[model samples]
Target: MTKQLASSAPDLPHLDLPHMGQVDDPWGGVGEGRLFTGAWVQARGGVIEVKEPATGRVLTLVGRAEAADVRAAAQAARVAQVDWAARAPTARAEVVEEAARVMGGMADTVVRWLMREAGSAGPKAQVEHQHALGFLRHAAAMGQEPQGHILASVPPRRSVAERVPLGVVGVIAPFNFPLVLALRAVAPALAAGNAVVLKPDPRTPVSGGFLIAQAFAAAGLPPGLLHVLPGGADVGQALCADPDIAMITFTGSTGAGRAVGELAGRHLKKVQLELGGKNALVILDDADIDLAARNAAWGAWLHQGQICMSTGRILVHHSLHDDLVTRLAAKARALPVGDPLDGVAIGPLIDPGQVARVDAIVQASVAAGARLVAGGTHDGRCYAPTVLAGVTPGMPAFDEEIFGPVAVVTAFADDDQAVDLANRGQYGLAAGVIGANVDRAVRLGARLRTGHLHINDQTVVAEPQAPFGGMGASGNGSRISGPANWDEFTTWRWTTVQPTAPAYPY
Candidate 1:
């Protein structure tokens, strides 16, 4: 069992909440209560109160937007994209790079917001900041890449193929890892000369939306180029259905992703969906016990395991299952869980409802005859790091994605059984294989049907410079990192020139 998270972080170094000056001018004199919908207009939707998950303290307020607001935001982006796209690609790149520089100065403010609003520990907040900046710079680099090719053609004719912006792009980012998720698409789309209408989850509007807007605006990005609307499902649907918005890029749950994809398909617009995962971590017989245990603990408990790529299942060879389980459970118990501001390795869930849902899954799995190897309880939203042994396919812990700090362990007979166990689920987001034999581990990873496979690594790894995405329920076969951006945010245009008349038209 875990103790209730306290309001103060007495054990950690000195901490200060955001005072009036720290957050006073984040919106350039606009009150913290309202969202900046491109034109500095107020939101038509009702007020949403931002609360600290551990203490239930109201941190700030933001608007919950309605569908009309989304349409207006999209229209504004449509109008601005013309001028924005008309600029030189290098100039666009400079603006994005400059935004990263300006945002670097606000690291303290960003960390505080992440800690209070998103329940991120210090290390995770730092990682988020660095990754957000990496995405921005990577987008800038992409803008400098050659977008067109001179094609070989028949005599007396020249052919060229170029990729151009898809005009206005709509982005919906989830509350978890909002900064990285929102920027990964938004930066690339903007760098490609497409204006973006971004819908941040209402649960984390400030850290997810306003911070990015402020940085870009401060960097001299043209007004109306981007609109940040913090809203719920209706607003997301409206953004997808807007006629001017050419594409919709969304990051969230699989159910929500399906809805977004369906709506965009109905409208004949492109959509990129990054959704849920029940990632697996496989421990082979030849692997180091301590290292495998460490990887499992990190993959399962980081950010309270709310991440989509969090390891949900651990498949170990029967020879090492018992010993590996014991070590991993001990490591899970040693980690502290509390308020994010307290500088603990693990932190609280977003709210009480999430706590109930996670606990209920753990309980159901136990009732289904799975052994509770470590933790099976919570105090408020601070659920203890949990481990379950003897999990099988029919149990809730095995089938459902328990997006909490819970690890489920299952034993396999051999390499073939390990492959079958890893590939048993619908989610194909990420998986990891740990073994002393590097060649054998890589060969095994190649057999698993996941988008991101790590050899001798954990499931929680991500790189801004690599192509990151998934298949099956995890995504729609679309990717959103590095060069993948060029495909997701732009379309092809073919141009041809003929000095002499041909057989056609004459």
Candidate 2:
């Protein structure tokens, strides 16, 4: 059992909650207070009330979905997908493009919901909203592009390969990046002409799931093309098992990803997973210690370090280890930790449970010989930005993905040792190398076994057109962003035609 630590720091003063009328009803006045399945319909299950992490204030009440609701949503998607696919790709692109425009218009409301529901700080919320818009527009553009190839076959036959939409895509998104994660998959899947059954984390129904449906609907997408069902594990299991759902794209913990992959495998359905990571930041001796410290602080403590690509481990060169640790610790201590709406540098964890989990990890790491360098205290939902040194390979702080505002540092003797130390963990999600020599840093980054790497930058970075996903335990074979996403949401069919009779071997 995880034990909670008594907070040694004082709580930050609370900010006044926004007016209720300002928050848009995600249901859009369809069902009285029910889940959105084409139109608002009452779920067979009960309701879930989301609470703000900073103050524990009631954010909103949303309907909780069950297996019956999942089936209904899946059926609706199955029916709508055929017509959606029949439409011109350009027409579909127009709808998605309109949705992006709508999202841009509603940026303020969306950012507020993200901060309240997902504990995102002001800047983080804004970035997530912007990224969501960019992703939507990118998807719209891809939808209009040519999607098939023609090739010469034997003799008089012509062979062609065309990309076709998978019937229904079941999207299960995480709470950390509620808006962006959902849109990252949803936009691409919709652009490919597949209907979507989105099951967002129950914790972020309005920000993560329903807001997406509202955007598309406002953009003039036909009813039933996207159904947002917010619920728990039961809902997710049902979505995975539904016969009508042809594919599953999930973003969450590695354990949950494994379970989802196994379930999808049993059904022989296509699945794309973007899971967790214990990312690392390597500081070479040639790096500027102050610059490295600032970048490391940003990557390790941003959004309370809830990001999947957060730098959980810092491997510094032996020569620079002491100086880097001192500078990084100072940076961590100075970060403002408070309410998300208050424009604080760091914010609360998603809930008390998350607070306890993070504290427990920190306590255990300290017990295992890791030295606490600075800020290992919590106040209410907020955990102070923390830095730990003397972390070793086998310690939990070094080996595990501590998803909090805490980072552990260890020293490496040389370049080869740094690479080995970075790759020793099971995760291969993201990494960073900080050095004055860009070429040397790039060479070292190439040797690291991570899916994405940065030189003289932080691990937590993403672009609209970058191929984003992980290898090994961090994710399965499928990737999410850039041109790579097209293959995951679509299937290729080879067609051959012979105008005239050709000699047949048979």
Candidate 3:
């Protein structure tokens, strides 16, 4: 049996709740009890509600829309976008900038809701909230500038390319990254002058939709320009299939992403799918076992391993496999698990379903002759950080994206075998190789099929300038936060202003 550390939940730092400011709690004046009541949605005709995953607490109610309602919301956004698109680029940028400012100031407020709703721990939740705000700020500061070009001197023919928005975008955000990922989609779409109807995860509507709506409203965006549709798969599928929705930017499972793609394809609409990842972490025999173990634990357990870029698979050299697993299990056990806001090192799975999923995967893996090396039990929504060894190629744990507090360890006899084991998974999102030989690791990294690879590092670190997304089943198209992302969200239209007489039609 894995030793359970005496549940010493860390002392979370004090945070003043309802940081939405006096008399301006976007929920309603801060003193108003109505905001906490389950009436906010009814008030907005069923838009959304804030549900805490740990205790099933309801923080705020919001619009719980249906298919027709989502369609109407999209139509409303389309109509509102007509004027929004006509606004000067500077004017549009101002709204997003103001949103960024508001979001920055309200980081505590958003983090509180994120902790409550998503069961994200203190520091990571705070970081993700800040990331969301930063992305919005950076997005606001970016825009398309004319880099006009002269065409070849073929008669009077001339052409120049200029970027333009894609009208209206339908944003379907994921549960694990309720706030940050939503902003990842919404900010760029808005910055590019597209109207967006945001469909936040129903499980975390408060943090994703309600809080964001408050920021947008404070930032002075048109009321209907950033419509919030808070509902379940039905609502999301409806939004995906809606013809008026010009583009779909979604972050979720591979299965769900595929469904979104098929639907969008049927409509001939562009879809950006940031889907599932079964990332690999290769531990070379020459690497520092302690360092690799710590990094691997962090990569696998952060967000309970729910993040798309998490290293779900670890291929260790047979020479160091036993030592690494022991170190990893100890490190994982040291992580505190409790109330997300209480500054524990880790928190619960996003919801009960996620917990169940994790439990099921762990059980299935163990039954298939895999060793349950550490931390596999569940307490309500909370799942202790887990590690599995002896996981083989034929097992479901190796084949599936185990979005939970579980890391499957397998040993490789040599570098070639390690690389082959890492590449065995169907999904190729992110991978890591920890080795002393940087040159050899780099060469081996090239051979890995993942979109992004980290040599002697964790796979999930996000830099604003880094191009972030995956290949194959992980993502379609792409979404990166830098200038690359700007390029993705824009369409270059070719135009020519006659500097001289036009050519006659032949």
Per-residue accuracy of model 3 over 121-163 as CA lDDT, tens digit each: 7677778888887788777767544423556656455666667
Q: Which residues of candidate 1, in runs, are more than 4 Å off?
A: 1-32, 500-506
Q: How would you order the candidates by TM-score, starting with the best?
A: 1, 2, 3
Most accurate candidate by TM-score: 1
Q: What 10-residue stretch in candidate 1 is worst by lDDT?
A: 12-21
Candidate 3 collision pairs: 12-342, 46-63, 46-64, 47-62, 47-63, 47-64, 48-62, 48-63, 49-62
In terms of TM-score, which candidate is stronger, 2 or 3? 2
Q: Candidate 2 at residue 39, lDDT?
A: 66
lDDT (Cα, tens digit) per residue for candidate 2, span 1-506: 00111121122111121111122243222223467766666656767777789988765667888898889889988998999999988899999999999889887678777877888887788889999999999999886677999876785778999999999999999999999999999998989999999999988888898788778888998898899888889888998899999999999899999999999889989989998898989999998888888888888999999999999888899999889888878887777888776667898999899889889988898999999999889999999999999999888888888889997899999999999999996889999999999999999999988898988888999987898999888999678888876788899999998887767899
lDDT values, one for every candidate: 0.85, 0.85, 0.77
lDDT, candidate 1, 1-506, per-residue tens? 21223233322121121211122223233233455655455566766777778777665667677888878778888899999999999999999999999878777777667877888877887789988999999998987798989999986789999989999999999988979999998899999999998888888887888889888988889988888888778888898899999999999899989989999999999999999999999999999988999999889988899999999899999999999889988887888888776667787899898999999999999999999989888988899999999999989999988889999999999999999999987899999999999999999999999999999998998878888889899999999988888889999999999987678875
RMSD of each: 3.9, 5.6, 5.0
Q: Between 2 and 3, whose lDDT is larger?
A: 2
